[model samples]
Target: MSHRESDRRQFLKKSAATAAAVSVPYFLTGQNAAAADEQKANESNDRPIVGCIGTGSRWHAVGPNAMQLGDVAAVCDVDANHAAGAKKKVTEIQSKKGSDRQVDVYEDYQKILDRKDIEIVTIVTTDHWHSKIAIEAMKAGKDVYCEKPLTLTIDEGKKICQVAKETGRVFQVGTQQRSEMGLRFLQAVALVRNGRIGEVQNIAVAIGGAPACNSIPVVDVPSGLNWEKWLGQAPLVDYRWAKNGNTVNTRCHYEFRWWYEYSGGKLTDWGAHHVDIAQWAIGQSEDGMGPRSIEPIYAKHPVDFKDGMPVQDDRYNTATQFHIKATFGDGVVMDIKDSHQDELGFDNGIMFMGTEGRFLVNRGKIVGAPVDALKENPLPENAIAEIYGGSMPARGNAHMANFFEAVKTRKLPISDVFTHHRALTTCHLSNIAIRLNRSLKWDPQTEQILGDDQANAMQSRDARKGYEVTV
Candidate 1:
């Protein structure tokens, strides 16, 4: 049978087995935000104390949702001014919304994490810091809502999941698209499972991974900035652009995406979102299992390799136009890459070609592939419930909203890490292929690349000292 058919069968089987394991939610997690705010302030259900690790634009993206969920108790940023600015914004929003909640400001994120009163923490820090801080927070008993791509390396991926399992903490990797309403993810995932599209064929995803951000010259580190701490793990480099009074040459905090040391580039940045949706559609995001084979099909080299893997390419290392193809055991081909050809989802979207028809889905929209498929939306039953193993969310809303709801009612959010892991595996695996530039076979159940020692080495990243993420 085709991969689609096999997956559908597996889904049905799993559904039968897990029907009693997960309880369906009544009205979604935490009481409505309006209700949450109106909670009588009876010492028992006062506002939830909230803290943040990073306060950039992305953190602002969830400002309203976070407010809906809890009070924005504190904001932290390495740059003193950045933290102050965020605190001001939070205070304004709270006051305007009549939240009657106080917001605090802190220069060090560790201080926020140290709090005993903090119920949930959001880590919007650089990618390098995600696993370490998140794991530490979970250890500290504060549930996390870390920004994505959740982990900087595959090993960290395993570590975070392992830690989460050990701690029983409710963690949500920030991929807001997972929470979008109209043209949501589940419809497409369900269609794939229901065989609305027939025997699956090769799938295509177009997303531009990190292009070179630019080779900025090194300069003096700005005042009030802990350049050493910012570099954290990953080799320490001189600070060039500290974003003080005027812009520095090029080096800076957010732009860290350009360098491999800090992030996986857009390969993991946008990949966090696009790759996530792709995984959900392909039914791969679960546990630590990965694709059957990964071929680093495309790169600029002189890139060193250790253990048969490429050494970190410091010069804008992340793939610019990397194209990777992963073939599943049952002949399902998944293509992931950056694109501009059409109005695809987040630089890329998931395109599935099956025996019956084809379907494409991304954060922005979910479109039918065949000309008539869009017209013939007459599937008999709830196709979503069929293929998703009845595990994904039944309702779609802001991603954080889902998480907050899940936290209260104890239901799984639409983008739980298990499934997202599968998606990230695809994204991270594509990196493995581009870096190694070789066809590598994999044993999904075992989660290892076979035969090729070189490709296997890229499975995990070598984190810098003091930043090693341990399970």
Candidate 2:
């Protein structure tokens, strides 16, 4: 067999071995106990060996969810505390399943990638580190399940897609709204595609604004944290930490989202979800089909910006209040604003207005005339499943389950990177326009800002030496 085929066979053998070990207790407990509780711990021997990287707060959820579907053999984090906590968490979870699987912990993620037995990996690192690790993991012959806002820059998105196509690995972007959230987002898409809303006119995505902060105090880096590794791909900087009375902020961990150097702020944080849903529903999700021009109506930054770059590094520099209008080639306008009170009327959801009617949908509820009409007129029985790309499973943590199922079937998961790139491209452009304080004409086919050399240059940043992502 070829080297790749050998790797695949080895992965299967290890997975089968792990599965059999976990099944011994279930077998001894009798068939009645197994039948009464099918918590996936007793279900199948087709488990894929999983390795979780970046076990921070977010991975606490993503990792545990994946443990339910796969055999988690390892957990890695740059922070020692997080790595230990994740090991404890994984051990407790496996204990409940009556399986004494030893989950190895690591400070360096490369160790996890080097393991040939690991068939799948979840990349829940900060926004900037995602592309590099994911690319490396795919190169290591493993499937990837990564959190959304997957790319730190537009160019990174391009690189990721190239690697994904070359590897033909099953990659799932964790935008749960597409698969979960009561399938409200799916029903919204179905309603639009079925012409229930007629020809689409405009979509308002209401992802709230980023928080502004004063210059944070530079302090000693915390013990058990690798500041250099955590700031991968981004510029080197001092660890900043401050507690203003009750509110605590830092240039590390969860607070990294506020810095432009590390993340795209709220634009990508929340925009990744709302924009993906809007683009998917309106059929602008494919490549070469996106906004023709993006106009920044209003933008308020926490710190002054000079030529699209933040002047101050110590403070939160992302846009605090912004309204970006992206007009497509077909004249359909997508308004991405901070909140509904910005005059769009919905706080944290999408509002679709078409020639025939309009509707709004968020996580909590889907409302408006079009949605209300669904009760009496009703969507077709197969409408939701068809929109979802297949039959839907029961809705508890179905996104990770979808990833594991794709691992078995060798099919792409619902939230693949291809369309996510398209949606994130729009969001990245919005940030560019706001930062530059100018309208930009875009060529989606070329993936560049037309007639604007400086804006096009902002599409990618120079990665710090030794952290650069090279194929």
Candidate 3:
């Protein structure tokens, strides 16, 4: 073995053996005796030594899938208490399997990366911190399983794609919709391409947008939590909960999704899933290609980012309503979302209304007019199109298992970053249009929004210092 590999082996041997003698929790001492042995054994047997970086409520739910996929060697979080909660679940798994794998815990994720034995790192941190740790973990030579909307800025997405390619590391973005089922639902899409849909006219999506945030009072950082690390790449503003002023206490945990500084809100949250389906439904995975033009007209209610800062308002800043018409080079019109009605509509899916017939697809179902058509004599086969699967992946429980499986095989998972970037590009444009409040034409080949300097600016975010996204 090379010197580096030899040192890694020695470190595992000593840490595991020595840690066993110390009866303290692994996070406190940075290693547990039994876990060190598990790490060494996993190495000899070729099983991946897995470590998770976030242990919030979401991780509590997603942990079992990863354990089923590989050996759970360690867990980390900014909060010690949260870490303990997650560590308990992992310990239970270890106990159930009767596998003596010790799960070391750490308040800081850097300690996990410092270990050369960890092969795959699952990052479920806040939206703002996703790219920061993901890029760093990949740099540390670990495969990354990052949650979606894997970037806080367009620049971050670009950097993540670049880093994955540069480091030769396998990276999977957790979009999850594309891998839910046995069938990909592409045959129907092939029919659409074969003109069975007959000259696609206008396509409409009805997903919602993120609300804007206003000024709120700063609160004390919780005890035993690494607030600075939590805010690693975000602005160094005082701590403010993502909830409204009166509800700030209710929003203390996991509600970080609604803040613009931390995330793009629904624009990225659900958009990552639905826009991905929309792109696949329309075959827009190829990054260099996108809508030729876009026009984001304000709905009756729109979030205004005046002076490039959020106004301190109690009402949410996310766009409750807005419309943007996307035009493709082939004269295909795709309406990403329609805000025509509020009571009930296709609010979270992609609908393609073609001349042949109107087809609609959502998470729960994919049904359309002439609904029985695919079942009928079906459209004649086309040499150009591959067979289309009938539906999106079932994300009820199997999402993370698929990710770990891909890691071991060194293959790109269904929700790989390359495909996600295109989908996110579309979703980001809607925000661009809404923020700029005007018509914008885009050059897909050029990857530029035409004519409006202000609209084009929203393509990237102002990353905080020490966390600027660079390729």
Candidate 4:
């Protein structure tokens, strides 16, 4: 074995041993354990104290949904305006619920982590900030509810998983498709698992392409915005703004996804959602199981590249169009691409095709020959119950409720971090293949790109000083 591989294996072994030493098993002996269990059950009825970080457009919905399950003790954002706005929204929601608790606002997230009273933290930060904050929060003894696309790079996923196992924290990824009210995703997974869809042959996931844009002009950093902290582990770049008509500086907020420095664009954005469900349905949503090979069949980016690195930093550099394919160990082929005119006839969603049946599923509907067959012979009750994590369909706030239940019981949630990391790794691999414009082989057990040094180097990136993410 190479020295690097040996070192990594040793580190992982040590981490697992440390985690085993710290983890408290579910069962304990004697009356003390019974008393402790009773105390925990009583505390579960009391509202959990929550703190929300990154109050952006998405958080407007996520923050309110979280409030339904917990008390909002604090709201935080790097931008002062966003923090204040979220604080006001929290107060309004609490008033409507007939609770008069006041919500605190902060420009720094560390203050929230420092508080002992906050039991849970909902992270809605940009793609680059997810793993760093999540690891720190777990170390601080706070359960985390992080948004999807859980890592900025493949190595970040491994770090987050290790820290979660070591701390035994209740870590939930925000892939709400798993708990959608109609259970469309769950039903599809159940059908395939129960042999309703013969042996799975192929899967297709259609996430739209990234946008192309000309170089944006650098502008003065806006007031009340800490640009340095916002750039956090990402490489430093001049602050740029969009010009409105003639002379208006619209500061960067939601547009960070288009840059390769900050995110993997649509590959990570929607891929985190749809590709995750595909992995779960195919029984690959676990540690040490992922795509064995990835190929970039076709691709186009907004800028030029040299050795897989984008040549320009000022333009929207992510792939604008692409068709990527991944092959698993069991010969299952997963084709991920932009909107394409194809036989599947789906513009957005997932499609599963097998010998006996085929089906298409999205947020709105699920249809196929297998579903039609289900009417004649309904799915077993146990199968349906297991898919919903032992709960029936149509439960209010099902995703958030599941996380809270896991927090109370110390059980893994439906979208736990380990499986989410495995799925996100597939997305990252697709992006890497596209950037390099070649086929690459992967070793899932070692978590490395095999026999290709250049591709292996893409597994991680160097963080700027003061923003390094270490387990």
Estimate every model's Cα lDDT from 0 to 1: 0.66, 0.84, 0.65, 0.82
Q: Model 3, 159-252: lDDT tens per residue?
A: 7878887887877787766544423334444555555666567777777754444555566777877777677666665665445445552123
Number of clashing pairs per prediction, in order: 16, 0, 21, 0
lDDT of 4 by residue, 73-131 (tens): 99999999889899899998888867788788888899999999999999998889998
lDDT of 1 at 470: 69
How does candidate 1 fare on TM-score? 0.85
TM-score to native of every candidate shown: 0.85, 0.91, 0.79, 0.89
- Give the per-residue Cα lDDT of candidate 2 at 259: 87
Q: Candidate order by TM-score, highest to lowest?
A: 2, 4, 1, 3
**Regions more than 4 Å wrong, model 2:** 1-43, 342-344
* C-alpha RMSD for every candidate: 4.1, 9.3, 12.8, 7.3
In model 2, pairs of residues that clash are none
The residue-level lDDT of candidate 2 at 31 comes to: 32
- Choose 1 or 3, whichever is better by lDDT: 1
36: Cα error in model 3, Å: 27
